[model samples]
Target: MKTARRYLASEIYRTTIAVILVLLGLFIFFDMIDALDNLNEKFTFVSLLYVQALQIPNRLYDLLPICVLIGTVIALAGLAQRNELVILRVSGISSKRLLWMLWLITIPFMIFAAFVSEVVTPYTEKKTSEFTISALGKNSTKMDSGYWFREPVDDAHYRVINIRRLNSSTEIDTITIFEYNTQDNQLSSVTNAAKGILQHGELRLDNVTTRTLTSNLAQVLTNEQAPLESISSLKTQKTISFKTSLTSERLVATELQPDKMSTPDLLNYVQYLEENNLQANRHIVALWRKGSYPFTLLVMITLAAPIGFVQSRKGGVGAKIFLGILIGIIFFMANQLALNVGMLNNLPPWLTALLPNIIALILAFGALYLMERRSKPRNFIHAK
Candidate 1:
């Protein structure tokens, strides 16, 4: 049993590594082709290649589950074609025992996936984004617009800030802030700055213009009454400093994305958003998904196990491989669909993330059970 397990592990690992390399090569080639249109005098072909190299970790992390499935199917089907699996089965190795061995062999892969998702991918993704933005000489934009943040001033007031462009974590341009009275939800003031600097938990606004509305003006605006004369006072300052919770690290977290964030960073960001009463559904979903990623590898292997149980006379290895690829695509699509549906309906984060995997596990186990039942009579006859 030990020898068989070792042999199975080695075969799966070898095939998985080969599959991952081929997939990565294909992905990088396509990415290089797509990056051609972005090349310029400053951003040359070499720079483009470097950027793609930085992105390889993230791509590998994304492709690991699919590669595992395909690799396992190919390895197991090849073994079955050579009658190795039949020999092992006839030697008192139950189908359930074989399934358990497959799951056991997947532990190393699960650990690798977890490490890549939690450590390597986040750092590489951030560097890729920063490098691309710097090379292109532009500000980073999120969701086709500027980065928006909400910060609480006190019980009675809160501020909404918009930055049109971010050159770096510490530098921003076209800053806009709107302060509102929490009691009446009335606009109290507006501040606009040409540029801003963040340092040591302090935000310094340069060339600032602030408009403050008087109580009467606020009432008038709330009542839809037009004021003929100037009702709000405007003030200009060369530079103004304020202590803020929006540190450079948090700014970078906001600028990149929730999915690109490490688990700890994503957790902190989600808490910050919830505390400020900001929308954090997407981040919450991403956090749950990240937490469940390791189990996703196990699920992929389970889905591939039954495909290898088919006899060589019934189906060729090519057909089994095609089936494996089809199942992998379906699993990917189902996961994405569940995420969107869960977000749209405001479902629980854990449920949204694990739904597809749970469903796949059930289907996989059922298929395994059927295969075991079908093989039992043959085993009994051989023993007699």
Candidate 2:
């Protein structure tokens, strides 16, 4: 049993590495082709290549589970084709034992996935985004409307901040802030700044203009009364300091997509959003999905295990690989669909994330059970 386990582990690891390399190369090639359209005097082909290289971790993180599935299927199907699987079974390794061995072998992969997702992917993704943005000379392309944040001032007041572009970690441009009165649910003020510097928990706005709506003006606006001089009073300042709870770290965190954030950062951001009474459903879903990734990979391996039991007479290795790919695609689509539908309908974050994995596990276990049932009759006949 030890020897069998070692052999299976070796085969799966070797095949998985090969698959990773092949898929990574293919993806890089596609990236190169796509990068062509973005080429310019400043953003040359080499710079684009460097950006693509930086994105490799994210690509690998996304592809790991599917690669594992395909590799497992190929390894097992090849063994079955050569009758090695039959020999192992005849040597008294039951199907259940083999399944357990596969799961055991998958532990290292789960660890690797966690490492990549938590450590490697986030750093590399941020670097890639920063590099691409710098190379392209684009300011606010990370988000179309800009990076928005909501900070509560008090029970009856809050501020909505919109930064058109982040020049750097400490610098911002085209800043717009909307201050609202929660008691009346009315906009109380709008602050616009040409640029800003963030330091020491204070944002210093240069060339600032603030429009404050008086109570009468607010009432007039709410009543749809049109009067030119009834407009809110506008105050301009050369420089103004605004204190905020958003530090540079929190600012950067808000700028990144939830998937590009580490789990801890994501959790913190989710809490921040909830505390500010902002919409965090999407981030919540992403948080749950990232947490459930290991289980998803386990399900992928389980799904692959049954494919290896097929004889060469029934289907070739190519067919089995194709089936593996199909399964992977289906799983990806189902997971995405669940995410979208769940977020749209406001489903629980954990349920939204784990629904597809649960369904896949059921299907995988059903396949395993059927395979075990078929093997039992054959084993009984052989014993008789």
| CA lDDT, every model vs. true structure | 0.88, 0.86
Q: Write the per-residue lDDT of candidate 2 for residues 2-105, one digit (tens) a residue.
A: 88999999999999999999999999999889879989998998898888888899889889989999999999999998899989988888888999999999
Local error of candidate 2 at residue 89 (angstroms): 0.4
Clashing pairs in 2: none
- What's the distance in Å from true for residue 33, model 2? 1.0
lDDT of 2 at 228: 58
**For all the candidates, what are their Cα RMSDs to the real structure?**
1.8, 2.1
**CA displacement after TM-score superposition, residue 332 of candidate 2 (Å):** 0.8
- The digit string of per-residue lDDT tens for model 1 on 124-232 reads 8778766766677566466556788889889899999888887776888999999998888888899999999999989999999999987665467677657767778
Error of 1 at 291 (Å): 1.5
* Model 2: ten consecutive residues of lowest lDDT: 133-142
